[model samples]
Target chain A: MFDAEKFIDQQVKKVRDEVEGRAIIAASGGVDSTVCAAIVSRAIGDRLLAVYVDTGFMRKGETANVDKMLGRLGVNHMVVDASDEYFDALKGVTDPERKRKVIGEKFIRVFEREAKKFDAGYLVQGTIAPDWIESGGGLRDTIKSHHNVGGLPADMHLKLVEPLRDLYKDEVRKVARALKIEVAEKQPFPGPALAIRVMGEPTRESVAIVREACAVTEDEIEKAAAAGEMKLPWQYFAVLLPVRSVGVQGDIRAYGFTIAVRAVDSVDAMSAVYSKIPHDVLERISTRITNTMKEKVNRVVYDITDKPPATIEWE
Target chain B: MVIDNGGQWTHREWRVLRDLGAESEIVPNTTPLENIKADGLVLSGGSPRVGLNAEAMGKCGEYIDKSGVPVIGICAGHQFMAAHLGGKAGPSKVPEFGKTLVSIDDEDDLFKGLPPTIVAWESHNDEVTELPPDFVPLAHSDNCAIQAMKHKTKPLYGLQFHPEVEHTDNGYEMFQAFIDVCQAHKKE
Candidate 1:
């Protein structure tokens, strides 16, 4: 029932009216932000600068891929490699909310520096409905402090602007299609990125293991979906759990970590059901992960829990 | 009017109404009774456990008592409705989440066009345990006894599962049926 063309026209006008001068958008190269960047660019033209920050917690090759993506969109953009700062700030931080808050504050600090050079006063985010709803405040209970909303510091210099605040992920995708953006159907990724995917301490070693496992999980799922073996899940990835299990690798006693393969089907990120990936596809994913990372990951299990019992991403 | 009790799907309820071509807005449950102007009202679910704390539900009790419109309660809202009306609501022995199969027992005004059994999405820590006087059970799931209920005379309804969410089967039609109920109540 949502009219994308009408929504786009109204949003462009609203952005033009609200933003008097220059603005810098936190473009994550995801559907919401990229679509946001496109709309903001249309409104402010060259006055809008798309700032993509690589927090060292992104997916494999995510930073470079986003870099090329922004170039193609023809939006004035820059990539800030704040990986070291993120890694350092997140050291010894284990709480899920704490990680989101820390990453949020760190993102603002990076954006502040960028804004000073670009002379921008407005900070545009691709924050959709679920981000704030799940974040919780006032009467609502805090489900999780999303990096964009509840994780935001109380005191910040930039005036916030979110064009997609009321819309959900599916609605955002509709807008993305209307705008003809390349990442229209991309899976929703948290702003905290791979940091939340790794449970407990997100040290360099843990992050690397999860990243590799995630890559393998994604590869196998995508391949199986392409081959018509299974429908592509709304979102799919691997989670690195802290608990260790014993296993036999190449006839040697190998003690290693476990990787949880998560895939869900949902219209919006608010509620989700575990994806019914075919047994053959799941076996392929499990075999590939254990074989590819035999030294570090010994066990791989699929997450069957739903949203109420378990969220999409593990802390 | 979609009364906001701070539930996650509260906005989804509002969106459903808007999509159905109804001019609807999400009014806080705390709002004064007189300020609300609508042909019907929807009591939204909340994060706070209605079974444990009813005060967190704000002025929802007042809205149900005096709003004088067709009303539908969901999740926590549904639980609060039964409790406020002298029924019983508490933590479910087997709380349901995500996917659930709800069997319609009455097919009241809200479930007019819906099938006897529907795949309803649910996320409730608490549920209506006992039927309030004059209220009849309309639906039930395997775990919970009262999945749906309706008043014998008044235009009131409650659903344990979320019909506003996309994953729910016939969610849109259910909303349209509610809209029809609201319209019929407005005429009366």
Candidate 2:
């Protein structure tokens, strides 16, 4: 029912009118932000700059994949390696909301520096309906502090230009398709990235473990879906839990952290049902994770909880 | 008009109305009854548990009593409707969230042409415990007894589960049915 073409035309005009000079968009290469970058780029042409910050918390190959994707899109984009700064800012931060806020502030600082060079006063974000809805302000209960919305620092300077604020993920995908963006159907990834995937303090070791486990989970699930063994879930990934348990490997006592494999089915992110991944697929994922990580990850559990009781992401 | 009570799905309700070709806007529950101009009204579910905190509902009771239009209450709004109309609402012994099996007890205007058993999405900490004097229960689920209800005389309805969400079966049909009710009422 959403008129993607009409929506794009209207948004481009709106952005052109609202933006006086140059603008910098926080492009994450996800469906929302990518679509947003394309829309803003069409409006202001070369005046618009897309800044992609590598938070060091991205999934394996994520930074490079995004870099190439942005280049092909023909958008004026730059990749900033703020990994060290992000890691330092998030050091010792364990609370989920606190971590999101820290990442959000860190992102703004990076964007601010880039904006200074570009002389851009306006910042565009691909914040969709669920991001602000779950972020909770006024009457709505705080479900999670999304890094883009609730995680925003009050002292932020740049004027925000959220073009897709009212639209949902499905609607955004429709727009992405209309625009022929490649990652239109990409799985939803939180702005906090791999930092939130780690339950406790996201040290280098924890981040690396979760990143590998996540890659393995994604690889197995995608293969199972492609092979017709199971239906592809709306979103799927792995979370590194801090709880460590004892196990035996090669007749040696092994103690290691746990990984949780999460997947769900939903049109919008508001409500979701746990994906009915076949036991075979789940078993494969579990074995692959434990085997790949060896003694570092002795246990891999499947999260069956729905969004009401449990959000899709562990954090 | 969709009266927003801060429910997460409040915007979803508005989106459903728009998809169904109804000119709808989300208004805060605090809006005065006279300021509302629409053929029908929907009181959206909110984080405020009506059973525990009624004052936070913000003149929703006034809208139900004074607004002359078809009204549908959802979740918190449903609880508040029952409470304001001399019924009872409280914390559910078994609170349901996410996917639920809702069985229609009556083919009311809202559930017209829908299957007997439907999949509905629920996210509620409290529920209507007792039916208001002039109201009858329309549906139920395993954990919650009164999933849906309607007034005997007034064009009033209530739903504990969310039909505006895409996960819910026949959500568009249910909303279309409500729109029909509103249109029919406007004709009279």
Candidate 3:
């Protein structure tokens, strides 16, 4: 049996012993990061500073919700509206690895700046096992460049402390439950944010298009699950592909981007089978996405590919 | 023990065995049978490109031929098993992937306590098209005909769907049944 309580007790002691002084943590408000923040806060008390960066690539309403969450937790935190910075850094970058490395280096520079302000020698992140595994080390094949693991700079200034390094996504959720964290049930969001979901170049306009598509995907999927039409998928979202197709919008020829909606069921993210979302729910999601963003997106399709061939996020 | 056939869930299969209180380890498929002294073997699921790399998966074929121990092949491993044993397997007519409802055709020791029908998790581009002689069909889905099969006289089984995944409701039950089969053979 996996004991979350025992794991929590040991991790807190480990964090307290490892983090000698003040530490700055990158709080993304996802289940992993939130649970990690809660655990680290219990260890260092007031010595921890939670920093959330609004990287413009975030999902709809992500920034505001995370801000409120930090305040409720009563953790000393700061919200850095670095959307412009991220957008500037990602300009004209299309290669997946380049995008991840750019974002990773940018994050470290931002944290190094904060680390100086707080005189914090440690930098905390919610990097779990999948982060490193998929990021691929010596013998492993690189699945995708996870920003936290793959994007990390070669010479980072601050010492890194990851409390949830060894745990899987499910284990992180258990820790969140054990600590009474409210965002325990929240679905996972990639560290690279919506950047990886945008198949090609991630521009300012491209980000806006995906943000709305993701919102619609979540709304329709969640509503259907609540209505008891189908069981909720472990993770569900929309990916805005760079490819465009011809479509008929009220008999007029329209050329627009295509959105690929994906959902999967998994205990740990190591392997996942595609979610068997009801056709009716998928139709609703398609109709809402194409109709709402008809000018920008006209074709909506569901990604039926499994994890072995297709990763959750399209890069 | 889990045979690492370059599959994504090879580790998960090992984890499931350990969780089920069975001694297990993920050994590469190329490991000699005598080296491990295992009671049974689990051939893990692999990539979408199953038929493309017969050379990479050739060792599994060798193991299935040489090792007479109780063996459970999963997904790509299942496809390879059928093909290796004079059966036919290729690109699935429907190319089934993701969650698909499977119906048990014949309840056997492999699917001992499982329900007649299950919402099993599936992820495969290729499937078993023809069963080898003496291999009996155990279960099937709408998209694919041979969802599962087992050797009539030998402790050999194959499953197209991933039983180690969390989505499968009776995943643990099936693993327990396989372990019991292994335990029985180990005693013999």
- Choose the strongest candidate by lDDT: 2
Cα lDDT of model 2 by residue, B1-188, tens digit: 99989999999998999877889999998898889998998999998574347778888888898888999998998898998998999999999988899999998888888899999989988999999999999999999999999999889999999999888999899889999999999999
Output the number of the DockQ-best candidate. 2
Candidate 2 DockQ vs. native: 0.76
Local accuracy of candidate 1 as per-residue lDDT tens digits, B75-188: 988898999999999989998888899999887777786789998889888899998999999989999999999999998888899999887999899889989988888888
lDDT of 1 by residue, A1-315 (tens): 789999999999999999989999999999999999999999999999999998888889999999999999999999998889999999999998899999999999899899999999999999999899889987788888898898777888999999999999999999999999999999989999999999987778888998898899899999999989889999999999988999998899999989999999988877788999998988988898899888888998999988866787775
Q: What are the clash counts of all predictions, listed in order?
A: 0, 0, 0
DockQ values per model? 0.68, 0.76, 0.18
- Supply the TM-score for candidate 3: 0.76
Colliding pairs, model 1:
none
Q: Each prediction's Cα lDDT score?
A: 0.90, 0.91, 0.85
> What is the iRMSD in Å for candidate 2?
1.2
Model 2 regions more than 4 Å off? B48-51
Q: Rank by TM-score, highest first.
A: 2, 1, 3
lDDT of 2 at A279: 94
Candidate 3 residues lying further than 4 Å off, grouped into runs, are A14-23, A95-98, A112-123, A129-142, A153-168, A216-312, B1-3, B18-41, B47-71, B76-95, B100-106, B116-119, B125-157, B185-188
- Each candidate's TM vs. the true structure? 0.98, 0.98, 0.76
Model 3 lDDT on a 0 to 1 scale: 0.85
